[model samples]
Target: MKLKRTMAILMAGVTCAGALAGCGGSGSKDTGSAASNSGGLTELTFVMASRDEFMSSIEEAMVAEAEPLGYKIVSQDAQNDSSKQIQYIETAVNGGAEAVICLPVDADGTQSLIDAVGEKNLVFVNRPPTNYSELAADNVTYVGSNEDTSGYYQGEYLANYFKQKGQKEVKYLMIQGTLGQVSTTKRSEGVIKALKDNGINPVEASAPVVADYDRPTAQEMIQPLLTSGKEFDCIIANNDAMALGAIEACKDAGVEINFPIVGIDCTADGAKAVQDGDMAMTVFQNPVGQGKGAVIAADNMINGKKLGTGMEELGALDTSGKDYSDSIFWIPFEPVTKDNVADYM
Candidate 1:
């Protein structure tokens, strides 16, 4: 009982404890990575990617998974700004955080932030980094799903759905997430590539996408496309939010697109939409699994725990791809069709 509790507390983010008390001596780049703050619970910091519903799921899961182990998790919302995210790291370092978990707003721009951790402890979620070396660095781990897998699943589903129905071509309106975000880029790439791989040449009905993974924004963005009189076989959104928005747009325009509209992040609403036949399907990007996996990895690393064989079964992503390593943990993604959507809801 005591052992389990200690493990939990160690990954706790920020609290009223002795975080500012002692251990003021900074070591490697990850200065406080393995140290305890004076007279307080271990301090950990979580830098949120944004405050959207999807991001909220990550935070809620982190708290649910980490708090019971006896840690107070402090969250810093970057509000889609990379500069502000760096500021959050400075705050964590000065506040004496033992470890920092971040869902980066800018994956390519996180090198400075990674440097800022100074070896204290760094775990990155959501965005998959282009720099593979960072994940293998000492005191650094990348905890996220395979960047292209979710998109691949979405594209694969569409291709198979149409192929099974004996359809030849697919005309899709791509409602993307944040334009430059790794999630957006990879998800879009995965879908496009997967479609091509499956012998499906997808046609884009809408050009100059309306980005930013917001429902209203997506709804608004699709309005122009609806009025353009272009035929669309389906909609592909980087997230469920945009997909839901597209649905709303169609309803308001009285445009019925009776096709398989696919999305990622089988969010609660997305799953419900599938049940009601509002959308065809979505992929389950496990926020709960990613959140808890981060805490567990941090706990084990701090205690000098080596990852054992068959660790790949944990199911976010397997360790066989480019990002595969002991330091990098991949969370697997699952496709949620109507036949299995109820299991998610």
Candidate 2:
């Protein structure tokens, strides 16, 4: 069943690829009773930052896991606006949602969301709030992979590539996700730390360019750099979309990539890129695991059970060696290179 679900999730990535990038959800804000509906279904609100390629996959998995269990997911997209996200949270709460599952637009604005939810169960998915540890409670928890681990895997792959080539000093271009995101900061810092830890002298080829995790923005941001004839040993990106963008930019500029280009989120296209030798490697941030985990967490919280109750069915959960209180649940990230990319695909 896990293998079948995994394949369905991978297929979802392809299906959701054509979804409008910044489109907001059409969920109505009508007020309703919090009690179970006439069909005996409990509604849980799922508010997303936006329906990007990878996020849409998570949404699909969440819906698949939720429906059969007699829970309805009322999904909303904030279109990357924090204000809209808060508004949606209030609307969900006012509309009698027993729980709210949010992929926050601004991690820093988590307090506002907490205040708006006001005693209802809350499960934060994917992007965790900046103050996650401090804010955790019986009714609130986080479900996602450790962001630092994602980049550390990228660095480990790159470090091994360079060490095998007997190169100690490496210059690289970095394509970053949205600034101010904890994922962006941690992923950027974690890779550098891993390279140094593995005895590699890493130097930036240029100041990192921010692309807000958009492929077209990343392609446009790095095109000039690729054409400028800057000598760099590799390219690093916060996620697969930007890495693919960098690959496209290099191809457009006729630059033969001779070095590693690493990223996170082994989306279907990213795994294919690794298999085809375009992307050196990527980290598999499991959407199926995260989506399932979020639903389980919210359900457990609403029932006054442990936050991680019944999550073991999803597979092993890596807590990153931290003895976190029950308020946090981590889904592990796997590194996908040419040798292992086929397994992910």
TM-score of every model versus the real structure = 0.85, 0.88
Using lDDT as the measure, which candidate wins? 2
Name the lDDT of candidate 2.
Answer: 0.78
Q: Mind giving the per-residue lDDT tens digits that candidate 1 earns over 267-336?
A: 8899999999999989988777677777665555455454212233443233243423545556667888
Report the Cα RMSD per candidate.
8.0, 8.9
lDDT of 1: 0.72
Please give, for residues 14-114, the per-residue lDDT of candidate 2 as tens digits. 11111222112211121234567677888888999998888888888888888886788778999988889889999987877778999998898888888
Residue range with the least summed lDDT across 10 consecutive positions in model 2? 8-17
User: How many clashes would you count in candidate 2?
Assistant: 0
Q: What is the number of backbone collisions in each predicted candidate, taken in the order shown?
A: 19, 0
